[model samples]
Target: MAHSRLQNINNLTTIDAKGAGIYIHIPFCKQACHYCDFHFSTSLKKKDEMIAAIITEIGMRKNELEGQVIQTIYFGGGTPSVLSNQEIQHIITAVYNNFTVIDNPEITLEANPDDLSNKRIAALSNTPINRLSIGIQSFFEEDLKLMNRAHNAKEAEDCIAAAVKHFDNISIDLIYGIPNMSNQRWLQNVAKALQFGVPHISSYALTVEPKTALYTFVKKGIITAPSDEAAQEQFLLLVDELEANGFIHYELSNFGKQGYFSQNNTAYWLGKKYLGIGPSAHSYNGTTRSWNVANNMLYLKSIQEGKLPSEQETLTLSDRYNEYIMTGLRTIWGVAVARVQQDFGQLYYDYLIAQLQPFLDNGLLSFKDGIITTTRKGKFLSDGIASDLFFLR
Candidate 1:
């Protein structure tokens, strides 16, 4: 049955007009990484219950995206790969039963290296999941130990070797800017990922989010905080190396070969509607945004009682315009002047143009053909620039 799904894998690489996506957050993991703060439990005791709640949430909110087609179904969070093939299939079947999914939707599974053993990867190849986003944070053992990742350095390399034989639409993640990592080591990390011949790579700086184990380490001086200067240098190095090797720096932290950009994430960046199921998952329509509660037990209890455990807010005009600016400037697609004028008003258009002038003059932003985009020199600072351009309420 899954072999038939492989026939259309090539067709699932690109994004289309099918605007809706479904993001299922699997909140169970084998263990928590030290540098992480996303919601997930270290125990698998409630795994079955959580899966039931996720499927129920899918049916209960079917009407939220009533007429839209689901172009992508993404399994993200603690470690989606921790679920068995049967469990994963059950949730997917539920989505198909409730939603109008595209004929060849891009179904992505976020797997950690340790969870993707040779047998596991082969079994997954037979499922509807066509894309694998492996979390190979670092190629060095020391870095892996520092981050407290479940997989060691060897498991990281071996998983990619095994995965490539079963999956072609693959993406591996790498983190740079660890406290003591040199630029040379970061380059080697990028080179190791390239050796696998995967189509997509999502690299991010190791940020010290408050309340994570890494934060505590930094606070107690057991580990030094990652330096901003070092991070920026590594970020620029990544951009040059990947772009030179034929990957487009399509988004701030994502690079992909042509026709291989992340369909699920691109949909979000383009302002498409998506339903986020499971604990701590966020959903967005054009006018409003909502998210499920982060507590796994509470989520299951609420769903069992036939109620939605989520909160939502309607977006104001300023909220919409500011979001467009933030997401637009992060991608190759620049913010359109006409869109601001048409979507907001002449007042917004004038304000945006006036605000962007400083960045335009300083070689940080470029304005061409009425679209505003960050220059090569400005890509690393895009977030800060986007904030300055925001229409403060």
Candidate 2:
């Protein structure tokens, strides 16, 4: 059955990802990473309540999608693997009962190396979750310790070996640009990931976000932050190595073998509608964007009282255009010229074209086939270049 599904993977995965996707955020983790700022609690005291609240939110927001077929169901968070298989399935069952899910939806669960025990992997294989996105930030003791991850180097390599036995559609995340990490170490990390034969790899440069432990340490001169030069060199090396290994650089921080690009993220990048349930999850339905409150206890109380604690913002024309530039520049699909003209207006399109000349001359961006895409030299600088092209309204 697994082999057959792998063969027919594209049908199950999001093709063009036009349909809406579902995002369920799990906000409990065994431990906190030093450089992280995502909303999550180390304590699992309210995990049961949190799951119930997520299910309630799904039921309440079912109508928000207006019967759009759900193509993808993503379990992302502080380590979705912290929940039992039954807990994961309960949320999925609620989705089916309240929402319109198409046949063979692409369901993904984000897990950490420490949580993916052999027994856990086998148990998860029995659930409806078809894909695993492992957070193997690094397969080195020094790096893992630097980030304060729960799993050590051996567990990182071991979990992938175990997970691939049950899942062919697997993606593992690797982080580069950690303080004191050499290019040699970065190359070895990527090489170790490739040795596992995983189909997808997501890599990111470590940054010190404010309020994170790393930030405080850096502010106090207890730790040095990753350098921009080091990050750029490592990122380029990552792209070169992964692409040479037959992986497609589908997005700025994502690479996948053919037919393995992340459907949930693809839907998001293409501006398709999605409903994000659970605390701190964000939702978009064409015109307006909304996000749930980041407070777990408050979210639980509000949902139990039949109210959703979320904030909504209606998108303006300028808001939509700027978003397009940012997401498009980071993706393999460049900003479509005709889309800018038809969706925004000639004025917006002209501004985009006007901004293109400078990047074009400097070989940072290229315009071809009525589309604008970043050049190799500009890939690392994609975010900065996209900001420069933004219509600051």
Candidate 3:
């Protein structure tokens, strides 16, 4: 019975009927992590203005997702936990006023360890926000210092202990492939997270993005570049450990227990429409994709003038096909051969099969029931394999 239930969670493909999602980007952080490249500011001076602009953007785009019910409301960041409870409530109220929401939408707040004190978690528990995605990247002092995370190792454990008391739906972020993280250390990290009993875990291989401090450190040989081979080994270890503990490897970078999959991200992988409100947030319908300007000042000025500070592009058939291949292969919902034929016609379907043949023959991908999914051996390489299957014109 337990096995069957887990299987059902792993096979989930569709989202709620007529459902969409909303993502609100809070662009302020207390400090910068060495490896982060996402748009964010370290200043809090403009936070009030930023919040007001975001609420206004939500109102202005109210009709954009007409007739669809919002299934998820995600507060992503520069660290959304920095907002006061009242501020968070105000933003959520704006969402309710502007859009039609489901009876109990999965509202998530991306938070940092330093900000989630016992008092703060209690306050957040009273709000409509029902889920927490905490940034507890590593529970080691060295790793925390290396990454320049604002919180210490003690704070990492402290926050989780406090959080589970108030929120049952919690997910924590972990990084596995830091330059000096050994396989044993990585295993220890996984062990520590399991001890916390978090139902969902999102782990990623740390890559130094261009222009980040990590990049500069690597360029100057102050820190060794992360090894791809090491990352692959650690990833496989994570899959084995997490799955042994009843966690489903639902996506390439995410693991969740039954009933704990991230609704917001699952909707995204299934190609559902969602509106993004704030600086550097992105929005997508089935046909086009748009993103707000990354500059906070520009976003504030435009929103103040009652204009959307964003740009959009329509997706061509080839673009759509490529995206499905990319997102589909990364999750349990493999790319459907029938979906390709029905949506893009015979030519695309044929081209996809031809491109996929080599990986299939090499045991990196498996095709059964007309669905093409990455095999366990191919999981780490899914992105590269997906690129090989792109329907380039």
Candidate 4:
């Protein structure tokens, strides 16, 4: 079954997502890499305490869901690879005991290439986690050093070999457009990842975000800012290479090898209701959205005092419509005009139709099966166009 045709007014205050997905945040890492801005501390100082609290929070927040079948369970992290097999299993068991997980739910765990030693891979094989997303940002030694990623070229290649022996649903991440990278090396990186025969690959163009170590270094003239022209050229080339190698360009930065899409993430892009647990985790229950504190200490203290440790807002009609436009436009499924009308009323329906006519006339978009999606050219400017067609009222 698919998610909802409707986007508003689900049974809120009903514990559990009606067709919810469960996301457990494993927020501890061995080191902080440059160009990384996610909320994780290098100190595993409170690792044990945090792990215990996450499980506790699951039980405490269990009633927030509706006892529906959980379609996916994803262990996203500071680096879930840092977690022990015992810790992983303990969390999985906690989820099973507290919630009604569906039969054959897709459980994915994200890892780092350096952590994928033979012993660890073999240990992970024994767990229920059927999928592994290894962060192989680049296969070039210089790029790895520049980004301060925890893996070398050898580890990048070897980790996949280790993982493939034990898991079929494997996805590897690659970051392209490094200032020091050449086209030849980028091509090699793509070829090497494909050589492992992994089912999915998520390739991203590197962007220097604010307050990151890379940002600081660039500001101090220690390193150059990202080259936009090079980034664009590399992205185009990467797409061509992957598509030629039989990968589907499922999303802007994601390509799936056949039927191996990341079900958990795909659900999020499609706006499925998923509950996030842990510090900095966000939860959606249809109309209102909530997120826990990003600070580990703040989250732990609040939950200890019997508070949800979260902030929430009820989504307005326009907010929901704009959200639908953004998420739905980025997918292969496209935006279904009829479904929008059914959920958001005819004024929204008519407004979108009228707004899109210019793009439709310009051949930047196409219409069929009562849905509208950007053509390949328009997809490059998808964000701007999607916003243009949104209902602002």
Candidate 4 lDDT over 276-377, as tens digits, reads 999889998779999889999998888778887889999998998998888777767789999899999999999998898898888778888898887876
What is the per-residue lDDT of model 1 for residues 4-34, given as tens digits with 9 covering 90 to 100?
A: 2222312434445556999999998888799
- Number of clashes recorded per candidate: 0, 0, 0, 6
Q: Considering only N, C-alpha and C atoms within 3 Å, which residue pairs clash in candidate 2? A: none
Clashes of 1: 0
**lDDT at 34 for candidate 2?**
95
Candidate 2 per-residue lDDT, tens place, 1-393, comes to: 241243232343435445799999999899999999999999999988888889888989888888588889999998899999999999999999998788778899999998999889988888899999999999999999989999999999999999888887999999999999999999999999999999999999999999899899889988887899999999999999999999989889999898888888888888899999999999999899999999888899899999989999999999999999999999889899999999999999999998899999999998999988999899999999999999985
Candidate 3 regions exceeding 4 Å error are 1-14
What are the runs in model 4 whose C-alpha is more than 4 Å off?
Answer: 1-18, 361-363
In order, the Cα lDDT scores of the candidates are: 0.90, 0.90, 0.91, 0.82
| Native-referenced Cα lDDT, model 4 | 0.82
TM-score of 1: 0.96
Worst 10 residues of 1 by lDDT: 1-10
Least well predicted 10-residue stretch by lDDT in candidate 3 = 1-10
- The weakest ten consecutive residues by lDDT in model 2 span 1-10
How much is 345 displaced in model 3, in angstroms?
Answer: 0.9
